[model samples]
Target: MKRWTHPQDFIALIVGVYALLSPLWTTTTSKATTTMVVLGALTAVLSVIELVRPDTLSIEGLTALMGVLFFISPWVMGFSDMRAMSWTAWAAGVITFVIGAADLRVTRSHRGTVATTL
Candidate 1:
């Protein structure tokens, strides 16, 4: 088993799980539930892959993309009127995006440093 190396990935995993479970507690239409489940699963799976292989830079981009999808899901999926669900998506999406972007920056900088030193 791969060791847990990144706290950001762990947080993202939590966010994914939350998103997956949110539809149960929140008022959701069929479309909203489907969107949440699919996006949440994608986020969770990507986070796990990142946790296992932190060097996989592409995963960060994918995660950020998931965040963007999540953020816009309320409007696109027609759930924007549901204040609680909308807020949840907005908050979770922002959090996921920041984590992915920040991690991507750090990882790239580290790579640059290594390349310079080598």
Candidate 2:
């Protein structure tokens, strides 16, 4: 019924889409838009991997990294002046990070259900 799969990954995917398209709703400088698009693309790509393969936690881990990057993009990209971009990055990044952490927790609790790599 598609009800028992990893919901965390699904949430990540949704968040990724939103982040990727965030530039459309907000008016920002070129740098901010570029940062948003790049970060969002990374999050989405990692999410797709998590869904199709569900391999080791590495994909989820990468997703988390992407989230972190997004959250800090405002500062790193030097576009903190744009409130919309900054806020969007923060929100999207936090959501993706939370999802990744939740997935990790779910897998850990599954009792060997999720495989790991060395």
Candidate 3:
């Protein structure tokens, strides 16, 4: 069996794909699409890194969390209209952030086990 569970892998894979494609479906005006695409790309890249190297997956959650927060900043801070991009951005951000937090928690909990075995 693999170190990471199937559901974890699937979720990560799906999220990574979504992040990569978000920019294509959304508007690109005023750098909005550019920013979203960049963030999504980052998430996808990091996820790939995690999949290939479980030992280095420690920061996946952090990356995801940061990406989501960055995506929602415009509306979260009252700088942009909530209906235009805020809701979608916020939804993406929250999901990514949760995934990141979960990954961080799982990675942290497993660290002790690995250490004790060493």
Model 1 TM-score, 2 decimals:
0.93
Which parts of model 2 have CA positions greater than 4 angstroms off?
Answer: 1-4, 111-118
Q: Give the TM-score of candidate 3.
A: 0.74
Q: What is the TM-score of each candidate against the true structure?
A: 0.93, 0.84, 0.74
Clashing pairs in 2: none
Error of 2 at 75 (Å): 0.5
By lDDT, is 1 or 2 better?
1
Model 1 weakest lDDT span, ten residues long = 1-10
Q: Return the number of clashes found in candidate 2.
A: 0
Please report, as a residue range, the 10-residue window in candidate 3 with the lowest summed lDDT: 1-10
Where does model 1 exceed 4 Å of error? 1-3
lDDT for model 1, please: 0.88
lDDT of 1 by residue, 48-116 (tens): 999988877588888888899999999999999989889988988998999889878777787899899
Candidate 3 local lDDT, 17-64, one digit each (tens): 675566666643555655556666666666666666667745666656
Model 1's C-alpha root-mean-square deviation from the true structure amounts to 1.9
Candidate 2: C-alpha RMSD to true structure equals 3.7
